[model samples]
Target: MGLDRAASIADLRLKAKRRIPRFAFDLVDGGAEAEVNLRRNEEAFEEVLLTPRYMVDVSRIDTGTEVFGESFAAPFGMAPIGMLNAFWPDADLTLARLCKRQNVPYVASSAASTTLEALAEAADGNGWFQLYVSSDDTVTEGLIARAEAAGYEVMMVTADVPAAGKRDRDIRNQLSVPFRFTPEVVLQCALNPRWALTSLKHGTPNVANYADLLQSATSYADVQKTLITPSFDWESLRRLRDRWKGKLLVKGILHPQDALRCAEMGCDGVVVSNHGGRQVAFGPPTIEALPAIAEALGGRIPILLDSGVRRGADFVRAKARGADFVLAGRALAYGVGAGGRAGAERAMEILLLELQRALGQLGVPRFADVTRSALSDMPASQD
Candidate 1:
């Protein structure tokens, strides 16, 4: 399908599914275990209904907002996604460039196929780095120093993956970084010649940030043992805060107490996410968890929400429900997967247009005007 015809994020996702191999597609699209929370995240947003005021002047709608001492053109930004090369060659750089051009935040993941410095340069040093803390102090410290040196202003420590979730789709597909090519996988790639040839020309995707460390490792399991921090805790956050001088935010927080603790510990912000339902199968939808966290913090710090944010109306719902910003992961990834840099641009274009239209329909002049009063009561069954 043409980019112009792909009118929504859902359309981009369908295009992505047809463009890439099943294993690669599943990596971006699937959630953990039974994906109960995955479905619920999107469903819960429908519970929030906007009450529009008629005959209001919305002729000058402004989508601009500021976060982390930087002004963004919109309240929505790209959430970090790992191994985007599985979607397209240099997908991380493509997204960074897109965000830079759009003047939106782009959080680069530690597990990305491109280096942090490369992504930072692509984003004109405006990108944020999302670190997956390691149990090893030296490794963690090295990453922080690298991010600082690369001119990343904000550091987001992911706190939810105490252990890896059981993602059944990846298990069934036997997905790995280097891709263990079984006959089934090979045939799937063969069917998608464009993706296979592009990947062949660009080279296979690897965890670029951990390239040096993985050099001595023999298998993906060994690489995982050296990278992920199964014991990350509040103490770890404290130590990281002391070492990293830039803005620090915590991702993967769903509970109000955890959000409050991050603020009390001097975190600049908290992203109310469940890792897009990739880390926890039964966790509450981010929308359901957002209000309590917002109330607990009382706007002490910016609270961003991720997971299942598809439409512009969903963005308005999140803001009305107390999210300072919203992050889109699968939507952007799907765009890149479907049509490279152009596809990614199309995704952002669609979102920007949708946000503008949503605001106009709601008779809100700016995103900051969105409040709890805008939302109608949830249905009794939904409540």
Candidate 2:
């Protein structure tokens, strides 16, 4: 379908599914085992309803907001997805460039296909690097120092994923980094000619950040052993912040006390996320934790949120409830997967327009005016 016909995030997702391979889509779309938390995150968005005010002149709406000591064109930004190139060619750079043009934050994952230097340069040193801490303090310290040298202004240490989630889809597809294809797997790739050709042309994908430190594993079992370990903890976060001289952010916080602890621990911000519901099956929805976390932070630190954010209305819902800004995950990746840099641009464009439209209808003159008064209590059953 044409871009004109793609009026909503759902439409863009549909387009993305058709263009990208099934394995790639599953990586972007799948969550933890059972996916109960994933479904709950989406459901939380629906539970909150906006009660708009009428007869208020809001012809000129300001969607702009400042977060992390930077002014953004809008209150929402792109959330990082690991191994994006596995979905589409050059996905990391494509999205980084798009975010740079749009003047919004773009997070780079440790598991991403591109390096921090490339993303920082492409994004004009405005990008944040999301680090997945290792058990070894020496390796973790070195990575943080490298990120600082790369000119990353924000250092986000992902506290979740102490152990990798049980993803059934990846197991079934046998989609490891250095892929080993059985007869059935080869046939599956052959059915999707574009994915097969790209894999052949580019050579198999490797984890960019870990490429130098951790070579491609000989088998899937080996990959699992290295990636999924129970060694990550609060000490890792302490070491990461101490080593990196930049804005420290803690992602994957879903508890009010945890958010408070982050601020006490000298974190500048905390992203209210459950790793897009990709890590925990029965965890609290990100939206459900926002108000409490925001209250806990009490303006000491910014609380950014992500998960199930697909529409401009979703951004409104998030901001009204307590989130300073919203982060889009699958929406942006799907956009990049569907097209390229253009698709990423289209994704941002759609959200900006939607935010403007929602602001106009809500009679809110500025994004700052969006308050708890604008939102009713979400159903308890929602979470």
- CA lDDT, every model vs. true structure: 0.88, 0.80
Q: Tell me the TM-score of model 2.
A: 0.93
TM-score of each: 0.97, 0.93
- Off-target runs (Cα >4 Å) in candidate 1 are 378-383
User: Which residue pairs collide in model 1, if any?
Assistant: none
Which candidate tops TM-score? Answer: 1
Instruction: Residues 196-238, candidate 1: write the lDDT tens digits.
Output: 9999999988889988888777666777776787888899899
